[model samples]
Target: MSVIFTRRSVRSYLPKPVEDDKIERILRAGFQAPSAHNKQPWEFLLVSDREDLKAIAGMSPWAGMVEKAPLAIACCADTERSKFDDSEGAWWVQDLSAATENILLQIEEEGLGGVWLGWYPDMERVKIFSARFALPSHIVPVSMIALGYPAHPHRPADRYDASRVHYGRWGVSWEESRSGA
Candidate 1:
């Protein structure tokens, strides 16, 4: 719970490289995420090369931090492993998102800093990343996580909002429901 509350999107990182064991643990956490209909469609691409990282940083305006981070993991979805095959069959997106969140949480637990960079739905970024990594047509890049030792400490903010939480219905607040109003 501390890890969940303390996790923050870290954009700045130190120059030191992250250890391989930490990387493995992070990946393992991603693999442990729950999937839709037990269809785990996630695949990871590790990019540590300075040149490649710079290239990735250029792929999106929000991804400039990748250029400085020692490691970046591209979380992808294997379309062939998806549960369905129609235009509305985007459950893989949710699965990949869960995996990405798990990875970020594990990064925080590992005492490292990390940020999630969106890639899917942006056709230009997706195409560039696919071509750069030579990913198969079935493999869709979902998110990129840039991680390493933190350049500075990140303090967590309490984001809990009771107003945003409904009890049994959309308009029924928790207090209203509790009081049987």
Candidate 2:
């Protein structure tokens, strides 16, 4: 829980390579995430070469410092298994979202830092990453997670607000229920 709470968006990283064992642990955690209908359509592509990372960074300037990170994993989704009522549908995005969250949390737990670079939300990134990797038509590039040892520590944030929690219905905050209201 401390890892989940302290997890922050780390945009920069130290020049240290992440150990394969730690990466395995993180990927294992991701694979453990629940998927709708047990249709696990996620595939991870690990990229560790500095030149490859540089190419990725060049494709997306927002990921400039990500080139310095020693490891990155491209989250790809297989559209074949995901169906909306027995037809080719787009339900894979939600399933992939759950998986992505698991990966992010796992990275934090593994004492590594990472940032989820959006690829699905933006068409530009989709084209860029897909063309770079030569992704198949059925596979969608969801995002790239830049991972490495943290160059700086993340300060804990108090973003949770008690007032934001509503019980049962709109605006009847959870705080009201604890007092038997």
Candidate 3:
């Protein structure tokens, strides 16, 4: 619960770098996420260089933090291993998302901050990353997250939206369910 309340998508971070031990823990937590048939098809790519971070930040709007954050982790999925029926593929993106969330939680627990930046839909960036990292053709880069000690204290986020909840039908109110309280 503490982690739940504290885990915020920090877009800015201090210039100091994160400890190597914490990176190990974050990777461990990411791998601990359950995968379909235990495929565990995720690969982590850590970037700590200023120049490389700047190049990547140029690719995505929400990724400017990559330039400032001390470290960035690329969550890539080995799409080839996502297959279950011995011949083809499955939903590896879902599996990778699970791992990403695990990393986010671990980030907060370890006193670090982060933001999940989307990249899966951007084909151009993928190509750039593929060549830059010398990744296998079968591997697909899904997302990147910036990590570091936060410069600001993040407040708990309320994901709640009362009007969006319905009792049964499209317009039916869930408010009645809480009646007689």
Candidate 4:
């Protein structure tokens, strides 16, 4: 729970590189995420090369932090591994999203700072990433995580808003639900 509360999007990072064991643990956490129909259509691309990291930063406007981070993991979806073929095939998006969240949580537990950079749904960024890494047509890049030691300390934000939480139905506030009204 501490990890969940303290996990913040860290854009600035120290120059130190992340350890291999920590990296392995983070990847393992991602693999442990739940998926629809047990499809588990996630693939990871590790980018550590300085030149490639810089190139990735240029690929997306919000990804400049990738250039300085010691490691970046591209959480991708292998469309061929999806469970459905029709409109439901898009379930891979949710699977990858869950995996990405797990990875970010693990990063926080590892005492590292990281940020999830959106990639998928942006056709230009996706195309650039695919061409740069030579990814197959079935492989779709979902998110890029830039991670390393923290350059600055960040405080946890308490965003628990009861007003946004509806109890049995829409507009039924938690207080009303508790009072059985």
- What are the per-residue Cα lDDT tens digits for candidate 2 across 1-181? 7777888888778888899899998898778878778889888889988898898898776888667889889888888766546655576777777777788899999888898887786788788788878888888988788988999988768798889999999999899898887
Candidates 2 and 3: which is better by lDDT?
3
Q: Which parts of model 2 have CA positions greater than 4 angstroms off?
A: 84-89
List model 1 lDDT by residue over 48-105, tens digit each. 9999999999999999999999999999999888856444578899999999999999
Please report the TM-score between candidate 1 and the true structure: 0.95
TM-score of 3: 0.89
Selected candidate, larger lDDT, 1 vs 3? 1
- Sum up the clashes in candidate 4: 0
| lDDT values, one for every candidate | 0.95, 0.84, 0.87, 0.94
**Per-residue alpha-carbon lDDT of candidate 4 for residues 51-73, written as tens digits (9 for 90 to 100):** 99999999998999999999999
Ranking by lDDT: 1, 4, 3, 2
Q: Who wins the TM-score comparison?
A: 4
What residue runs in model 3 are displaced by over 4 Å at the alpha carbon?
86-90, 166-175, 178-181
Candidate 1, which segments miss by more than 4 Å at Cα? 84-88, 179-181
- Scored against the true structure, residue 46 in model 3 reaches a CA lDDT of 94
lDDT value, residue 180 of candidate 3: 35
